[model samples]
Target: MAKRKGKGPTPKAEDRHWHGKRQKARAAKNAKRTGTPTMGPSGRPTATDSPRPSGRPAGARRAAGDSPELVTGRNPVVEALRAGVPGTALYVMSGTDERIRESIQMAADRRIPLLETGKNELDRLTDGAVHQGIALQVRPYRYAHPDDLLKGTAPLIVALDGITDPRNLGAIVRSAAAFGATGVVVPERRAAGVTAGAWKTSAGTLASVPVAQATNLTRQLKAYQQAGCFVAGLDARGSTPVADLEVASGPFVLVVGSEGKGLGRLVADTCDMLVTIPMPGKAESLNAGVAAGIALYEISRLRS
Candidate 1:
């Protein structure tokens, strides 16, 4: 077979400029002191001082959109391993903490290959993230289509609106799993995608729970309503208590949004009903994750 060609998309100029500015300044200063021109041997300006690629690995920040994502930092890596996020390889160095060794052992047990990389190379690979001498490369997540999650008898779906945090997405997925929901749906744009942080937060529940993306959240919720599912939007000002939402016994979809701003106006209008979680204490609002969890639990309880 002929050798492969084409390196891929051209990196931005900033990413290409890995050379230290101090070195270039020093070179210019020397040239000025000697009364000589500062140029490469070939007489081209900036030719001798050309920026070199970091040679960052595939999962690095430089290639984020590319398949696979690198889980950097020691605690995150260990959590990923413990959560059983499917990994392709473990890039690590020596003299790390006990957590690193534990992660290595986990990788070995799972038959995931360990490639010993140096500090500089690992830094380049992670795009300057604190890797703590260890990182795990996980396969790209395959998202389910919004309609694909509509299957199953009396399917229950959870739709998220403007929830940008991956950890919140993971928590919602976990609750969806616990409450026997069909799947979780998130807006395709301006929403969090499955990442290392989500994997760690889900504690591996994400492996079984599928997350679907919707191009338009309100439209998708309308579709769900047309399909005969009762759509409920969780908001602080809602008049209906989540516990009394007897609609959970049948086809249902619960929409959640950010805590600060609550649900978007369009999404709120799309829902068939609006439900609120009652809190008698001094607390004001719940986090997206916690709110989703409480709502899902109540819905589950009502269904049971």
Candidate 2:
């Protein structure tokens, strides 16, 4: 233990290009163990080269943001593995087909790991954007309160004041989980979380909704209008019309704004109704997740 004097030599042009790449990798592994036909280094002929397997495996050199990528698509990786979304990893790209290989074998029957890689290494792990070639790394989207959506069952909620993208907050949480709306409210300082191109444009609806982030969205829309609910506010200077808003009768709350400023005056005075979405053509507004899915399908056809 007393001779530790290492870090001392090899720098003359990296020791003559590391001894000419260690003698051309020992003459291409002795001409690939001797039928004598080697060439490569792009001079071609290593039997039309496409071999590649001499290195990478210390976690494949890991670094694209050191993981937590999730570049989404293919039904948001089968709805983020049927919305359990815990510990995910799923990468997929190399020749993906059979419905993205049955959504990566339903994210490997739920143990989640997947991996694959190729489409230019998943476009260099999602930096080139459009990860429609499917990409996922996982862990981040969590939010769920307002008393766990008031013990859920059809609560109807939406908020989103300063809607900062993330693919329009994963397509307004896949149109508030396809019309019945149970939870979603943003603005933890002008938002945009649940990434992976907003879960590939929320084809998985950010893994079965429940967003809640507010720090005081006009006092949680006046505490969802003192609990009896009904808070509407999608204003194109609305005077009611989201096909006559009511949103699934019972408990409601829909306030959409900030696509270049739409409803913010203490969140449109804690709305009790402002409604809009009647666009008689010549589009002026609609795309805050299609005006929050036409104001949550007019609050689910005024609660059936």
Candidate 3:
């Protein structure tokens, strides 16, 4: 050899194997700390990247035991499940009730978590309401914008001016779904949003009906008017009768007022026509839901 001795001793096989193991351990630790997959040699996700099927995603599993809506009663829970409500879990009291069994089966069918708890816990979850030994934890409802209602195929829509009753809102939603109304619009403030009660009252029809919230109902009515929809306000002393209204066959927005007050002056004035459902008896008026249902029925009939 010509004195060319610059190379050091080659590493042993054991050393090389230990170094490879150390690198893999470090990579796995880093992956665990960052909650990401261990990158492969090509910097791509591998089979190890698959998350363990332990619990729900982060922030989805509520530890505080508070849910957005706790749907109580067997019928309500069953209907909610049938309506495809986004349920987190189903809580059934420790019993052998057939309804609870049905609920459990339904939840299992939908992959919804099922928990067996004491009746007292169910009562606590429902705030002492009549839970009927069952409760469903559902996600909050997401309301659409006023314009979304107008984009549907059906031009018939219902606008609630000041209806604050959640049941009425739910009934209106149910009626809207039944009568082929495209959607329902309510004011964003001073009115009822879709709540658990509304969902229950709607008999699961809330899933199909799109409810929109408007910043300014009068402005929304004006916008509907500009869009070639006849804005009609339901009132006692309206100019047009629900039965004889010619615009029912066309694109129309039926505006129902609050239970106590008929309609606001601005909203009533903004209407292209005022409609009254004829009552043969001396009853002054009807509830918001009944009135809306009647109007929807007449419109549906006219369209058919």
Candidate 4:
């Protein structure tokens, strides 16, 4: 069958409004979700219609000072909650296993906002890291000044020099708490801060043991020296054996260096005395955490 065209030539295909009415609806929804104004002063399109990669609200991408720390994984979340880590919200993936039930209960008991999200959304929030179906948004850790750590009549303090591993820091914090040490001092830069991993590794002792940050560790050690605290640097090669150290029972600052590199030159030179842990085994050295733990235990024993 032949049909005659009525208009001039065939009506050209016009560009359709791809966004159309749906785009406006989506923009309004997003504006409400993000707490943004839906329209501009002149009634222009002010709201964002584009979808976020992680499906999170636009308000989530706030300033660094306002952004929440994301602590993922079931065990970490549970431990952070148990340790009373300040939290803003607890997110659980829909259909998550029973492993996270305790975390849920803890969050509920603490009155933390509990949110259920899809697996993909959860993955986006954790930056594709293995979250194990749960994540906790916690506040940043507040660090004390080096002098503040020494204010109390604490006989022992542990200072970390270039120890970049958060787990090691956490272990050291835990060891210090167990040994009745006053606090831990870490460098303000080029060092591990009290992060979520550290919090988890501390096994809930972070709350009790204060962590202080020093702008200059060498200077801080010197200050400690002036305050009548002996500065003992832990190195493989030292003139004094940790066990036979005469100052073990006195107020002391035990400085532990990084595993790869020992203490910095200035830090090494600032020590009142260098001490070595006597190793009878064939192994060259112990892990930084293990070494710190051993030194702390010895100091505690001698003090006791």
Candidate 5:
């Protein structure tokens, strides 16, 4: 074979790749130098990357470790502390609350770090997420077993067959707390985890209710049923109407499925009875949160 010396000039495809990268770099540099915004790959200037005045005044972004960010207000931060969020840090506005006096005392006793800041400073740190004037910097949420939550009283458990929306989960938690439900059960996978958005959407109700995540939802339902709880699945096609269902004044569980697709067949089969909410309007179905709220409130009313 004839000897081929060194490789020739780079192929056109290779040249184009390097050229594209160089062009991107040059564009970014020009934008930085001229103080002109550059379009992103989607042909839009990134709102976050664009230079803008700090939302807070000077000294607002306090140096890290100067103090943990303040969690303020009455219910949220106090409930967070009471719920045993690990490593909670608290800051209260001086003389802002007399209602939280007991909560403040508890914080002092627990040796949770405490400081006082202006309401504006508290507002800056919380980004307006209902600090209730008390803010806590703590670890993420911790979930427990549904039965564990029901240890003392007959549990009113909300079992989600396939709820994947963080907002819906939050809303359900809020409703569960309002209706005095003991816990919320969700599947381990194909579902939304307890994230900040869910916590926030719960409007601080997450602190009030225990949440359980199950590896097998059907098996968990069976466990609840065996534990003397009535397992009811919410299905539009169910033979029973939620209003008409003869609910015993005992421990019960209600299951709500995912949006778009209804309950998984296995989960539906696990329920002792499937209940439906009657809708006479043009809408064929309800949002997961709304449906969950109705069922929870009805159960609460019946139990009471």
Candidate 6:
């Protein structure tokens, strides 16, 4: 048999989400008018439902670092520090590098513990990633409950479904903060958690915009609907454009999904409305971050 050929270098995390595909919009052969997922006879998930790397199963992408909580590298560490990512300690090795000294100074200023160790230990700490003799251990993120986001008379909340990328979560939080969203809700499992990458990309907005974790996203969405909140999920198959949402001025929850998979089956069904962002551009769809930003902007405009 012929040997398996290589797939070439992997794409970056930011570029992998719905970026490579450029085909024209095709009708969802099995999709219903409601845009719900069609299951196989055995009730197993379809090809789109199967867990694969990024949106396209053919191409793969690697994350920027070994771990989200342990931010490593000279530039990343400094940027995380500048972005005010909450940290417990700053690990470093003795070196004349100016960035290392600068990291030490910042850690000292922020009262983060400084743990000097050998290069070997640094590599081990970073899981053999390129550390450049520095790493920062981010404090474990504190997640909120779904109900805690219900604040004020008409609160807006953003819930993420199938969005495992922390950067996308950060971008959504930033949008949420701008549009007066109460907080963000994410599934406790199979979803992105607040991490150093999230903090950096959020530009510290995560601090103000608390992210709540839900054990069952579908249940939480139902609960929101029961509590008199309009639930909307962003999807390419949505009939109603986001700008025309009828319940914008009321208590609302906007759900965003991953780039490739869009909204999961049950989560999409849970939404009161599946809202689409009408993109007249040649592109077929937008990533979660961009989609959330546009949807939130439209919702805010409607509320205003």
Best by lDDT: 1
Local distance difference test, each candidate: 0.81, 0.66, 0.78, 0.78, 0.70, 0.79
TM for every model, in the order presented, reads: 0.78, 0.28, 0.69, 0.74, 0.57, 0.76
How many Å off is the CA of 131 in candidate 2?
24
Q: Candidate 4 deviates by what RMSD?
A: 9.7
Clashing pairs in 2: 70-136, 70-137, 71-135, 247-299, 248-299, 248-303, 249-303
Q: For candidate 2, lDDT tens digit of each residue in 191-259?
A: 675655566667766667778777778987887778777787888898778776545477777788866
In candidate 6, residue 53 scores what lDDT? 15
Mark the regions of model 6 whose C-alpha exceeds 4 Å error after superposition: 1-68
List the candidate 4 regions with Cα displacement exceeding 4 Å.
1-66, 79-86, 118-124, 152-154
| 1 against 5, candidate with superior lDDT | 1
What TM value does model 2 have?
A: 0.28
lDDT tens digits, residue span 1-304, model 6:
9999999999875677664342212324324333344566878444332121111111112222222257778888888888888876777887578888888899999898787778876655555677787877776677888999999889999999998888898899998998889999999887887877788889999889989999999999999999889998999989999998969899999999888999999999888889999988899779899999999999999999
Give the alpha carbon lDDT tens digit for every residue of 10-91 in model 4. 4433434554677778887777576455554777433132122231232122113324567777776777778776676777
Model 5 is weakest, by summed lDDT over 10 consecutive residues, at 57-66
Native-referenced Cα lDDT, model 2:
0.66
Model 3: per-residue Cα lDDT over 127-155, one tens digit each: 56777787777766778888888864448
Instruction: After superposing candidate 3 on the true structure, give the runs of residues whose Cα lies further than 4 Å from its correct spot.
Output: 1-67, 73-86, 117-133, 152-154
Worst 10 residues of 3 by lDDT: 57-66
